[model samples]
Each structure stands twice: as C-alpha cells, then as structure tokens.
Target: MNFFSASYNSNQDLLDHLKSRGFLESETVYQAMKLIPRGDFLPVELLDSAYQDSPLRCSRYGFNASAPHIYGKCLSELEIEQGNSVLDIGTGTGHFAALASYLCGSLGRVHGLDIKSEIVNFARSNTETFKSKSGLNINVEYFVRNCFLADPDDNVYDRIYVGAACPKDYVHQLLKALSPNGIMIVPAGEELLKYVKVDGKLKVQYLLGVRYSELELPHQHEIQISYIQHEREKSLKVLIPKNGIDQSFRLLINDQKFSDVQLYILGNKTPINVHSFIFYCRIPSFFKEFIEPQQINLSESPLVSILLPDFVTEKNLMMVLEYVYCAKLIDPTIFESNNSSPDQVNLELDNLHETLLYFKIDSLVEYFDNVSTILQNPQPFNLFQDCQSKHLQMLVQSFNKIPENIGTDYTFHFKGGDIDIISSETVPHLLEISDFYDDQFLKSHCESILAKSVEIDNVVCLYILSSRLNAKQLFRICKEFIIENYPKVSKTANFQDLDKELLCQLLQDSCSYFQLLFDRNDSKIKSVELNETHSQNL
Candidate 1:
C-alpha cells in the first residue's frame, strides 16, 4: 500500500490518485465519490480547494469537510451496503451524506444531523442542488439537532458516521441506536476509530490519527419542551415495542400453552412442545416435514407429536430452538457451565455443530463448526524452544506437495501451499517464527486464520495477542468482535486484565491517544459533561 501520495489537480484526478494508493478499494465508493463533485458542497470562496486532497472549510461554524482520502478510508471501513439506513452525525455541508446516499442506492435512507441550523440548511440546499443537476436519486434528509443524542431505540441505523471528535461518554449512547451488526466510524481526539455493534455491544478498532474539532455540545437550557415533544412524536411512529417481536417468539419456546406440536426425542420421555407458526416462519423446510400426511392427524387435536432422530439431544434441541425463535445464539458456556466437565463440553459442542448442520441452519452451523474445529486442533507451538525436529517435520509435511527438494532449510523450499492452520492457538508462535524468517505468506495466513477463528470465548485473548504481535488486521477483527459482543465479552476474565491504555481506547475515550501530551505533574483535562436529551409525551 502507498502510505504517502501527492496532491491532485481536480476531483477525477484525486479519485484516480486515491484509487492508486489503495484508498478507494470499493467500486461502489469509487463511483459515488467520483460522481459527486465536492465543490458543490463547499462555499464559493473555498471552492478552489474542493478538489485538493485536503480538508476544506465548508461551514462558517468551524466544520471542515474531511479530506477525500479520509472519506475513502471511512467509506471502506463502513462498507455501507444497499438498503442500509445510515446516520451521518455532524453532517456539515452533506458532502459525505451525498456520497453515502449514492453508495447505499435508492432503496436506502440517510439521515443527516447537525446542531447548527445554518449548517443543516446548507447541507439540505447543497444536496437538493446536486440532485437537480446530476439527476441521481439520492434519498437523504437533513435535520437540525444535537449531534451527540442518538435515538434510544436499539434497532435503528445500519451504519453511523460521526464527523466530529466524539467524546467517550457518548459512545455507549450512540451505540444504542445502531442495529446489531451495524458499523460506526468516528474520530476520537487524535485517533480515527471504527466501532461495529454486534449482539448489542461494540467492537472498537483504531484507524489512524487526525485533528478534528470536538463534537458540539448543546447547552443545558436548550432542552426545552419543544424538543421533548419532537422526540415523542418520532417515537410514536414505531408501532412495535423494541425487540417485541423477538421476545414474543422467544417466550413461546417449550411453552405448552401455545404449542401446537410436541417433538419426541430418543431416550427422553417428555416431548418438547413448540409453536408450529414459529417453525413455519423460521424453517419452512422443517415445517414441510411437520405437515406431511403421515405426520399430521387432523381428526384429533392439532397437537401432533413426532419422534426426532437419536442425534437430537435435549440440550442441543433447546439451543437450536433459541436460534429458531429469535435468531439468537445461546451462549455456548451455558451448555455445561453448572454440571458438565471439559470433555463433556467439547462433546456437546461437537454435537451442537452437527445438529445445526443437520437442521440446515447455515450461519449457526458455520459458527459452531469453527468453534469445535479450533478447540480440537493441536496446541500452540512453544516459541522458547529452538527449531525442533518435530516442528520441522510438521512444516515439511504441511507442504510435502511442493516441487522443491526436501532440504535442511525447509523454510526456503516451502514457498507456499495449501497449509491448513493446526489451531488458532498456534497463531502467536507462528506469527513470531514467520516474522523471524520473513515469511510473508505464512504470516498472512496465520493472521487470516486467527482473525477468522475469533469466537466469543477467545476473542479477548486474541485481541491481547494481536496487540503483542502488532497484528493490525487481526487486532481490527478482534476489536470488532469484542464490540459486537461487548456485554458477553466484557464478562470474560481476560477483559478485566486488558492493559489500562487499551481498555481506555476500547471505551472510545477521546483522550486515550493524547495522554502522551499530558504532563506527569499537571492535572489532565476535565471530562466533557454529558447533558442527555430527554423525551416527554406531549
């Protein structure tokens, strides 16, 4: 990757330069960035510098449109897919919002928010003018509101981008609005960070360093009745309670009151009562089996009981139903936490992986299979020892198909091959050995496998490992997984042991990167006061 590049003359020139430097990786982002002229979003006086690969002052309120490269990096991190609902905080003149709209396409909706009414209006005017001239159907709306306050509902935006430096205190608040698996990128002090919301938590990754104005805070007195009324009006539009559908379906599992079918498992006397509607909705193929002529008895009550295969254990069955009912995965630890031993837990995991595959739940199947496979793989190599004969033998066996002669210097002969990682546990040792030998292929493969093998149980360990190895890609993935499963990952014992600096960074503290500037004897800057916006049913 070109870490440094020269400035360009025009918009197309800048796009080409950024693309060459590996900044504009996504074709969608490239096209959108190319089609939208940055000059249209800038003031007439500053229009001369619009095409420059540098930040330009777009608003009189001290808001600057980020450099084109910055936008490129942000877009690549967000990976805004089609039909996504995106929130652009600190929308400025709506340049990024326009690009995001184009990337998300016509089916997606983009909401741009800014505390300054003038800035909001400017963004609105710019976008309207662009739409008129370009004739591109960009669905985006701008609103005059506090940038820090996000919607309280959890299932709203698919992606969020904060243009200003976000203070740490507000990170959790903003996360409440992101949908599960959604991504948010924001600058915090000197570091640009990306956070992915997974399983109702955040995974944080540090992108780079930059200077950005702190997020504008609304005055305490600005919280007037009108704002509360507006918020209440917005909340009224959501008919279903937050997670209402999920909870309703989840509560139905094994509840005899509403169950229309009883599933009989081998060796278990009692059958598991379940709602037919749930199976019909979630697993249409399985539902077809239930409706077969031989399985159904209309003459009797609709409560039909069918014998399940021997492989369906009671423990595994409940876990499967948890996913079927609400698309939620029961924590794997709960399978044998109270009574089962380690061997039993491993066996249960294997059975669960098989069960998911048998049911054709592709996502869960892949997840459980990965977990099981990693757990059963060989232990990590011992870095302290010299190149042992067995280690060399294993390496040679891994690449036996290579045409080169099997010599003493196996590292030189084994250029690359279909080498399967024995275990994610071996990543740390392999990373060091590969780095020592300057094996880019092996090092990359180790990083890829370590990143892919990230599970809730070992994510914290992998994160700490990445930091020690200075594995940027692996660290990014681990950070993201941690964010998505924060509630669960935080409880892991390893979380409490994270380095203080890393923990601060993970929490999105704006000052984490700037601590080096703080004097040892002098007091540090005071934390930003949080004045949360409230709502009233007017």
Candidate 2:
C-alpha cells in the first residue's frame, strides 16, 4: 500500500501520534481536524496515510501539503478570534480552511484558493463534514485560481494565511488583502519561519527546526527585508509646555532630520496628549555631551524639555531619534553601549559613524567632519566602501553650498589667556552690536542662521529661527531637505498651516513654469476641451 493509503487507514493512530508531539493543542483544532476526513482530499494511492503527522505528496514536481504538526503550529500562532474572515492561499486539503472556519464561527468566513483544480475539489469534498457538524454554518469557499495575483474587486479579508513557504515579496499582495488589524501567518525564509502582518508589524518566533517544500507563486518582485535581531532601546515620554514659545522648536542633529521621537504631554496623575515625533538623534543625549556650556544655559530656559539619564553618543542618539521620528521601532540592542571613558566613547563613535554611513544618513558625514576637526584627526576613507556609493555621493553633493561672505571689523577685549578669562565677561552692549553687524551684512541672514541652527546640536536655536524665517523659504528648504535627506521625517513633523500654503504656492509656481515650457498644441487643446465636455455630460 502507498504512504497516503497507509496513513488514511490509521487516522486515529496518526492523530494520537500528533497529540504526543504536542501538535494538536486546542480542542477546537482537534475536533475540526478529526471531522474534516483527510482521506477524501488525498489521492486513493496515498489515502492510507492522509492523517499522518508527516507531509504527503499531493501533485507532481514536489507540490505537497505540510505535516500535521506544522499545520497545527501555524494555526496556533494565528490566534484566531471569532468573526474573522480568513483567506488561505495554497489551500491543499482544505482541512486548514475548515479548521479556520470552525474557529471563526457563523460570523466568520474562510476563502481557500489553489492553482490545482483537483486539489481545490478535493478540499471542498473533505470539508463537507464541517458544514453539517458545526450547524453554526461556517462558510468555506474554494477556488481554483492563482493566489499570488489578487482579484482587484476582493480586498475584504480580515486574516490571510499563506500555506506555502514564499519569498518576502509575496507580503505586498497579502498585506493588500489584510484589514488594518488583521494577522497573516506564513513560513518565510529557507530554514526559518516568520509570522508577519500581526498588529501592523512583523514578528518572528522560532519554531522547531525543520525544512518544508517551497510553495510556488508568480514572478518574483522587489521587496525590502530588514533583518533585526531582538534587542530593546530606551524610551522616554516628554511633555510640551502649554505656552506657544516652544512652537518653532523641532529636533535635529548634524543636519539630519529627527522627527518621530515620542513627545508626550504630562497631565494630572498620568501622561496625556502624546505627540509622536521622529528625529535623527536623541536630543537629551546630544544636549548632555556635544552642546557647549553656554548653549546649555539657553536650553534650560525652554518651556519643554526631554530628560534622559546617563550619557549616549550623538550618533546612537540620532539613530534612536530617526527611528522614533519615522514612527518605526528598532531593537533595543542598537542603543546599548559599553560605558567606558573617552577612549571607549571614541571607539563607539567610530562604529556609529560607520553605521550611519551604511544606512546613508547624509548629515552624519558633516557630523564626522566636525568631530574630526575637534579630534584633529582624519578618518579612514574606506570605512564605508561596501555601502551604496551613489547614496554617499548624493550626501556629498547636498553639502555643496555657496559660503556667504560677511565683511566685518570688530574688536574684542580679553582680560587673560586662561586664568583671568573667568574673571572677565564679554560686555552685553558689544555683543549686541556684533549681532546687529552680522545681521546687517548677510542676505537672508536670519533664514541662513535658522537653517544653520538646525544643522548644529542647538534644538532651541533651530526652533526659534525656524519660527522667524520667511515661510516660503523655510517651507521650500524643509520640504527639499526632508525629501532628499530624510523622507521619514515628514511623517512626524507638525508643520504650521502657513507652511502648507507656502508649499501650494511653490507647486503653483512650478506648474506655471511647466506650462510655459510645454505650450499645448491647438489640436491637443481642442481634444482636452472636448474630453472635459464629455466628462461633464457623463
């Protein structure tokens, strides 16, 4: 007798074996499994072993259904709640779909599809018992169509479970079908299983080591896969003061945008009114280490503040800030550092500089330049050679700016070189004159200063200048910088209504220029007029 024939004959014995292996955990799953009648789905030759815990060949060229244990684990991980509409891809025996239908109840629906017509027919036949027994009338639809290409009209699935091991690219279609809070459990990697689309994020939990047959899908497509090992990062909840003085303030580091850092408002007994912002670096860490003592005095007066205990490098801080600003979470290990003296700090900074380069953080190059100047040492050129060269070149190109020339004739009175420097302070009137002189000499000087403020580690200065700069220029700069250097920052930054108006103006201006450059032909204009008339009539 064939393997399937043998397995089908010992259905009770196979189920017992599966129980001993901890495959059949829930009573609902077990009952559904027992009632589904696997023998009906299997070919007559392999019907004997239909109920076995091992995988069985169902078609040519290595197409097979997963073992009972794997199927059970996948179902358990699904955490199915009642009233869920599940779409099962590569629904082999239709057994899993029947089980899902049972769990989802009367309100729930399970749609199973397969490339093979015979397999789909077999599944439909196998699940007939479930329809009669549940009386809850679980609806299970079987279709003989490809699962990879989605039907444009059907995008109403609550949960999607892919029955075969597919490449990560398949996630797009599954994601398109899944509802906002739906779960999609699929076997991802060659030897590893990853459960994704759970709670709007991807999570991987290790399962018993085993390899399974690859589920065939359509042509491969490009997909980004970011592999993060498990680790935790520090999180802080900060409150913004009610006063409007803090309005202009947005966080940044080394010119990189840090917009999705979590900003929460403190209320009575509990934190209320959470505002999520992302930035390229941790503000608290940068404030503690990089900014000068005089700058700290200015920062302390801000209506709002971010408090973080312990010191973190400017680079790590930026990474955390960028992750938060993008509203993307990172593993905690990315924030962990070996706390030593300046030597260890320098080493970690080197590692961080390399990481920034790898990830193509544009401002980090300037930051490294500033650090190099402070250290009076040059960095190794080949550190980031393996990273995408074009991305690095773009960063370099963005830094090319025409230096503004300012003419100045100023005098400073100093008491001493080192010892007596503490005894004397720069006269307030003289400082004011110097500020006025600088203001008078530069073109759009105030705007440049504000732009530079963000470039520095001065969050307060950046905010103040950002508020005072010409709305049109500031919006243009912010939009261009964000689009070029940090696309993720736009997700978190709360731009003023005026900023939107400025952007609209810029778009209108650009449209006018485009119209001048490409004047429409008389025939094309006539066609457009006719099309508009037809549209209006329709």
Find the candidate with the highest TM-score and give its number: 1
- Model 2, global lDDT: 0.48
lDDT of each: 0.69, 0.48
Which residue pairs in model 1 clash with each other?
198-484, 201-483, 202-483, 203-483
> Candidate 2's residue-wise lDDT over 1-538, tens digit each?
4422234346677666666668778766666666555565566777666676568887642367777777676677676778889889888878778778878888888899888887777778767754666554557999877665545345567777777776666556666777766667766655445445555676655565656566766532211110000010000111222422111221222222321122222232221111111111222233234232323355433222333322334445455444422322333233235556777666666666654444344444554546535245333222111222222122223323211111111111110101111111211222222233222212132343334334322332233333343223333454334333333443444332235554465457556634543443444566678889999999
> In candidate 2, where is summed lDDT lowest over 10 consecutive residues?
226-235
lDDT of 1: 0.69
Q: Compose the digit string of candidate 1's lDDT tens values, residues 168-263.
A: 766766676678899999887778999987776778999988888888765423323334434544432313224433454566688886556788
Q: Give the TM-score comparing model 1 with the true structure, all chains together.
A: 0.45
Q: Return the lDDT, model 1, position 461.
A: 86
How high is the lDDT of residue 9 in model 1?
Answer: 69
